[model samples]
Target: MRRVVLRGFSTEGGPRPDRTALLSLGLVVLFAPLAALSLLPLLWPLRLAGVPLSLGYTVWACSAGLYGLRPVQLALARLLWPVRRPTAAERERLDLVWSRVLRRAAVSERRFRIWVVDLADVNAHCVGRDLICVTTGALAELGDRELAGVLAHELGHHLRMHTAAAAFLVWVLLPLQALALLGSGLALPFARLGRHLRRTERGFGARRWALIAAGRLEAGLRLAFAAPGVVAFAVKNAAGREAEYQVDAYAVDLGFGAELLSALRWFEACAAPAAVAPLVPGPRRARHAAAREARPTHPPLERRMAAIIARLDAAPAAVPPQGRGRGRSESSRTLLP
Candidate 1:
């Protein structure tokens, strides 16, 4: 039942750090390119028709196109994820929490539509421009403040257009994934052939040498096809880690740093031990395990917590005013007037 208080480091009365400036920088770097890419398919016809579009015009067209897809994306999300409508009691709680969060963040209440899934995992994510999905386990486990923190973290993703960016990037990377799949398919026959040769080769003679050569050929082919995708995957995950940090900073700016940190700790505790276990005893085993853990799409929880704490320490203490319904009695601040 301990509370985490964020302390400010500025003592000289220097100018407060600009949250707007930071948000703007994140938008330009993280959202702009993805917005442009999402527009590309829609604008292709204009370029094909020889409309002579400028770069600025093209970007405008793309933004419009991406905006148009929001409804369709929301529909697809509902179909794929299949969340149930909130019951009367659940709806009341959701409305209270969401309204307070929107008021605190100064965002329009209509901008986001919240969905609760029947999943058991304590997870939540922003699906599209407006769709915020949370698992039932999250609702059951998190207090009102913790739930608000989780929502704020997801809201950060929405505000920065990270979901759109991710969707666009996935489209861009589809071909690379396909190539990797194709390579695996192609290598399967060669691998089978090598295995067959090894099985038929009865002794250490010409047949054994031929079997070794076949195995080598199979390995080479697999590497040739899989290497590009392997590199791309690594790069994509690296970018994803940075994006996670950016959104964490956004949540802290929303005055939910302590809650989010606590939520993350809960997640770490819930995760399987092997998922976060230290490297194995041997030197090589430990080294390889370390590399595998480092390759995940999000940075490790310890690193993320450290980064958020550092950012909070440097951030101005009074940027976002605390919301009215942030305590155990938050349900009293319902949207029902």
Candidate 2:
């Protein structure tokens, strides 16, 4: 671990941006203009070289949110999202685990708000700058050690600015998401009409025209509204996966490799029953495999576990820190896999 500083927070063993986090910021820059173009109808023509006031404002807001201004944090994290709050029992456990994790990293517990997600799957995530959410299932399933590892991974995202940059990218691209939804949805009716015309055999020329028109319309709408996101995902998801690996490295460096590896085993166990099920009968399996290959958001679970094992194998033996965090005995450490 090296000394690093981020958004007014500095620590000896803190988060730093890796290639993936940089790539996320790059995507935010690349897509912001396209999103502005899509939202042009919302604003009348104005100054700033065909860019509207709204786009400028969006840039400002995104920048502010990225650096983690308190007001922006409150607005973006508190009001805009209907995130589930932790129950009393859940909070008690979360607080104890969280304090240890943050303490080890030298991050302020005050800097982040812990929330609970009402999900059955074991997962945790960070968003914007200061929010770390763990699923209810995770709270139920993971003991303090395993939960600490998961939380460490998310805290790494915050320190590296992964979630903050991702939030900016998502916010700036909202217009494009909206456009895709509206334009692509309208194509279904036209598609049905074209099919109806083909069945009626309405004069060969007219039927041909109907097919051509509807097909072109659907294709154009898809290209214009829906395709950019796919292209962007193709460009960015690689980096996103790499960022996960980097955070895994961070967790290892921060002394949670063993704990995190155990957590991954739990995830693997949870998924085993489903992975062993018979494949859906058809070429669909091949198509789905191809799709997963084309754009996987996270590295495969096995790959992550392998990487963690490799890190743990190569790491030096754990040396006690200057302070005994939470006054736990050295025998109970979660450093090695």
Indicate which candidate wins on TM-score.
2
Candidate 2: RMSD over Cα atoms? 8.8
Write the residue-wise lDDT of candidate 2 on 1-337 in tens digits.
2221111223345456655678788888888778777766445445445866766666645664454665565455444334477888888878998898888888877878888766555667675677776766677766677778888888887888887776566666667666767677878787787678777765658778878798888778766777776666556656666667777877877877777766666555543333321211111111010011112556566666667767776442342221112234234434333
Screening candidate 1 with a backbone cut-off below 3 angstroms (N, C-alpha, C), the clashing residue pairs are: 39-62
- Model 1, span 203-272: residue lDDT tens: 8998888888778877887777666546655655555555566667767777777667656655555544
lDDT of 1 at 7: 29
After superposing candidate 1, which stretches have Cα over 4 Å from the reference?
A: 1-68, 75-82, 271-295, 314-337
Question: Residue 301, candidate 1: how far off, in angstroms?
Answer: 0.3
Error of 1 at 137 (Å): 0.7
* True-vs-predicted CA distance for residue 189, candidate 2, Å: 5.2
Local distance difference test, each candidate = 0.58, 0.63
Query: TM-scores, in order shown?
Result: 0.66, 0.72
